[model samples]
Target: MQLIKLCDFRQPFSLNDVGCGYGALLAFLAKRHRGAKVDYLGTDLSQAMIDQAKPSPRPSMRSQFVVTGDIPRVADYSVASGIFNVKLNQPTVRWTLFIQQTLAGMHAASRLGFAVNFLAPPGPDMQAIPELYRVSPDVWASHCERQFGAKVELIEGYGMREFTLLVRR
Candidate 1:
């Protein structure tokens, strides 16, 4: 939804879907941007996801699905949706490292920018949970700005329990 608006779509460009699952985002983009030219690549770590997304790829755009540890090619823009939500018992330090590495990769692989969403930290009245990672938007946005020298924006107040970080290079 909001992730699609992270970059300008009036011109031809490439997009890398980091951690894409089943190509649903690709399909939605293709449908939403019918007249705009786009090159879409969806990368996932799971072979099953790639397999499921390979068939009947979106016809509105040049599309490919790859099972890879990282995006294999540079694109005009990139997005990671719901990738940082699941912590799965991983220590916060280790997961933060993974986020740093992944965001670094995203910055290096995109010519324009990248967008990612993180589950918002629970309120003081609510107890923190272990299975899900609830992070402060400022924490990661500041990290992107400092580490990548990118103009970072935090999009919130959408009535959702999450926020998006739009990093422009």
Candidate 2:
């Protein structure tokens, strides 16, 4: 819900959910924003995920699901939820580069803005894990501002283990 709040839903808009799995977010968005018209396009690398994503029958909304390696079209806003949390044994530097590239792509694919969440680095009482990519908000906020010249908003303190970066073009 916090990630969706980053978008302006006062009017009709299109959304591209990168790495969207099973289209749960699309359903949630449609159900939550009853008055807002939304055209949702969800993309995933796994065909199984795409197959499992049932299209919404809401007359106010239209949806498409695809199994693609990248975003297929531009949208008014894009939100990638829980996409960067898993590193899958990749080196930290390598995963960081992947994140940078993905953010660049998301920025290019969105007309209004984009939001993404990252797992925050564990506190002193928590032990660090190698398979997950826990990133500091400052790192990607600075990157978005520098690379895309975007007005970046760091959304934290939501009682979640992660923080969101809202980059407005």
Candidate 3:
């Protein structure tokens, strides 16, 4: 969330990190923004992941998961990272449908929309990944723009050709 820190998070917020593998990033951001004291919710299909979560020596502020099928539970100004890249091995339609559902959940709570990442065209993270619904960063940009009615703002990272898009509606 280094890039996110560089942006405007001035709005009062609650963030949802969907499919949060192990709450590493969620804990980091929650800790980092402790002064703001925003409510942060992180969800993963695996209960083991959440059980293992340890928020380093912070106040009572923390991360927890709402059930998957319940999207309206998350609050506004939500964020998600690396949603699509991990689901590469699933059927395209299935994964895309999942994307829609996930966004719908986030949108149900988000007033500012969500943020995500994808490798640049030709897929920087393509290798060793199951090639299910893999597509270029541009395609993902268009898809989000079309689907979410938001502009896809892209930033090329320090060491990789891949780009991060912070989309807002």
Q: Each candidate's TM vs. the true structure? A: 0.94, 0.97, 0.76
lDDT of 3: 0.63
lDDT of 1 by residue, 23-117 (tens): 98877876777776778889999999888885333454788889998889999999999999998999989999999999999999999999999
Candidate 1, residue 11: the lDDT equals 82
- Candidate 1: worst 10 consecutive residues by lDDT? 52-61
lDDT, residue 87, model 1: 88
User: Please, what is the whole-model Cα lDDT of each candidate in the order they appear?
Assistant: 0.89, 0.89, 0.63
- In model 3, the worst 10-residue window by lDDT is 2-11
Residue 98 lDDT (model 3):
78
Q: Per-residue lDDT for 1-169 in model 3, tens only?
A: 5335423556556666676767777567655766555566777767777677655345545456544535446466566666666664577788878777776666566776667665454444446456624456677668778877886676776576456767777
The TM-score-based order of candidates, best leading, equals: 2, 1, 3
lDDT of 1: 0.89
